[model samples]
Target: MKSSILASAAILAASLEPVAALSEPLQNILINTDRSPIYRYPTDVTRGIIPIPVHSHNDYWRDVPFYTALSAGCISIEADVFLFNDTLYVGHEESALTKERTLQSLYIEPLMSVLKKTNPKSPFVSGPTRHGVFDASSGQTLYLWIDVKNNGEKAWPHIIKALQPLRDANYLTKVQNNETFVPGPVTVIGTGGTPLSQVVSAADRDYFYDGPLKDLTGFTSLVSPIASTSLMEVVGDIKSDSENPLNPTQLEAIRKQIKAAKDKSIGVRYWETPGWPIRLRNELWRMLWKEGVALLNADDVNAAKEYF
Candidate 1:
């Protein structure tokens, strides 16, 4: 009985060895047979999403600032920044600022994180890459508009310092040798209280000025890649029920502004467009697109996304 038991145990062990040996190879075959090799590019984060020529107005108001606009396919985003104790705070007003919501926390750091992912280091990669947020269009550059809420001169330095992370990563679009405008993943435009002198003086600076759309005499892609103006200021208020949304005068103004900016190779954007009466708002959007507006300034990204 002992001999028989020993022989049976040896047979069982022998049988299990073949099963264990086959298991790993069989599993690998099962796992890899139908699936292709996994590969990923740096800008794959925004894969499958098509970008639109829309500016996310007051972008920080969203629950997820950078990501919200990115997901919505808005190529441009804005943040209102105020300097307090040498720290850059982001909000529409001073009352809206919180300690946690900062220029670094809200925009710079987040942008760096996204850019880093889009420009990863790998053996397969030959050299440096400047991939933008959009995987569908890797050449697309995200526009970051910084509106200085107060104390332009005092706040300017802080804004520059805050951008070091991006600058170090070569993620910010720059004017090299004061002539070559090399576009990176992100372009920073200083608006509101941002001084024109400061931006233009530094010919090779990464940041640019949001020049007056109504007057861009000396501005170029180097100093002002994009120019913006209020729609009401330039085109006047639209009558709520008027079939001719943009009258002859307003139409001419729109064409002139767009032509002026585009002639200088600078894009044009119009803010403070009518919001209420959904029909009129949509009609204006259509008209703006028809007029060849570079960016459609939109407070509501979801609605704007739907429009496109």
Candidate 2:
């Protein structure tokens, strides 16, 4: 009897060992004194914050909101690329292009510096490291959404060639000419006049595609669509007028679109919504969240962060 009792106790103890090992106390325990909260959020999770890239119009240096948004953990940022004379500048429109604030000066240089201090081998870094710089690890990547404001035909090759160095070094992602190239750790989202069938085919070869459901349906109707092996990112570019924050019909349309995309188990994003007004943000967030929209694009990161 004593032997049997001891044997049962040992088995019970063994069973509990795994659970005990897995359990961690939910209390504060400092690992390092000078830790940054950059990686506080998990990358796999969908609460990614994306800031609109600063342009020459905004005093990029004095843009406190933009920097604050980035420092506070915006996972993605956009920059409009235009070749002026021989240099690439970040500006929303061609009219705003200038020589002083080139893309490298405004964004690339600063980004490269930050990356060097964080991830020295980051394809963005150029020269030797500065002494006594913080050896920080690169946290979640920033999606350098290069919005090509130029004609698709004229800009494709030039942009591709210019990005070669970054592409080769595995820092740039190209989203043009209907080919989604995911070379290295960088993900390029192509956005040219490529047929959906061609985009879908390339996606099968391990590329990401962004499209609207309406457009995709039209593509499928033409051909026996292959099982979409690549990830699908949906966008709802909702329009707003002064009469209503967003027209009732427009809101309903967005809802239907979101539903259709979610039904197919694809990630969704909405753009061109109103600015960071509380009522508008809340309404959009509630509606989009209900339809299972995965990401929210905001003009102001702070407003979006509050809603999320």
Candidate 3:
């Protein structure tokens, strides 16, 4: 098995050799069921990280959150945040929140550790080399899509404060004088009612806005690095026949939205796509992939990684 969990079913299936004699490292992904928080394989160093364009939707819900998607080469990950009592708790809703599971614990702290590993302090380099999350492509900016599940106007300041760890380390991408976007280890994007007014108003801000893909006419890359829209909103319920791959109207709608986002030099991501009728879902994935969408929004990182 691949060092990453379900990293490559294709590789596992194509090896053709007998499975009984597979090496320990080869068997790690296939048989390793050690789910204890402390259970980390020795092979992680060699396995390392690869950056893929796929976005890990609801990333905190995964078995290991950010690490799981990173293991599978997903460069983008999201968290639904609800701020309360001066702490940003991560959960799908308030009911699911736990004091133990905070934005800092689940994301910020872990990412700081990952960045620490990648961007090692050394005499070899003159200063801090802003290496990104994945070791494979250390210079590639990892997108941290923060969805404001609560009141953005109230929670945003706390959210910015929560980013101090990254900011202090100089790991966050920042804008200089509202014109130049200096890419760094992580690019923080605000989505899901995350106050565009606040984002645009900041003349010197590390975070950016997530614009609507359907209408990005007024926006620019300086503010929104990525323009996003709901897939269901863009193309109606996906019903693909094997013979007829796409309804012309739906296909046209997709092209228009993609073009709209691309015109502003921003990447496009379609969230809330179809899930059931697995065939239709796969078809949509393929469609998005083929159309050259910047990042494919996904819940199944393993399948998405394999698809690419």
Top-scoring candidate (lDDT): 1
Assess every candidate by TM-score. Answer: 0.86, 0.53, 0.84
Q: What is the lDDT of residue 262 in candidate 1?
A: 88
Preferred candidate (lDDT higher): 1 or 2: 1
User: What stretches of model 1 exceed 4 Å from their correct place?
Assistant: 1-43
C-alpha lDDT score of every prediction, in listed order:
0.88, 0.45, 0.85
- Candidates 2 and 3 compared: the better one by TM-score is 3
lDDT measured at residue 116 in model 1 versus the true structure, 0 to 100: 76
What tens digits encode model 3's per-residue C-alpha lDDT throughout 1-308?
35565757656776876657778786885565576446754224414566778999999899899888888888899999998987899999989999999999999999888888777777778997888877667788889999999988999999999999999999999999999989998999999869988898989999998888888878999999898888887776666556344688988898988887787788889899766566776888888878879998888899888777
| lDDT of candidate 1 over 1-308, digit per residue (tens) | 99999999999999878444557877897777547445434456778888999999999999999889899999999999999999999999989999999999988888877777777787787988888888888789999999999999989988988989988888889997789988888999999999888887885789999989989887788888889999999877798798668899999999999998989998889999987788888899999899888899888888999999
Compared with the true structure, model 1 gives a TM-score of: 0.86
Clashes within 3 Å, all models in order: 1, 3, 1
Better of 1 and 3 by lDDT: 1
Candidate ordering by TM-score (highest first): 1, 3, 2
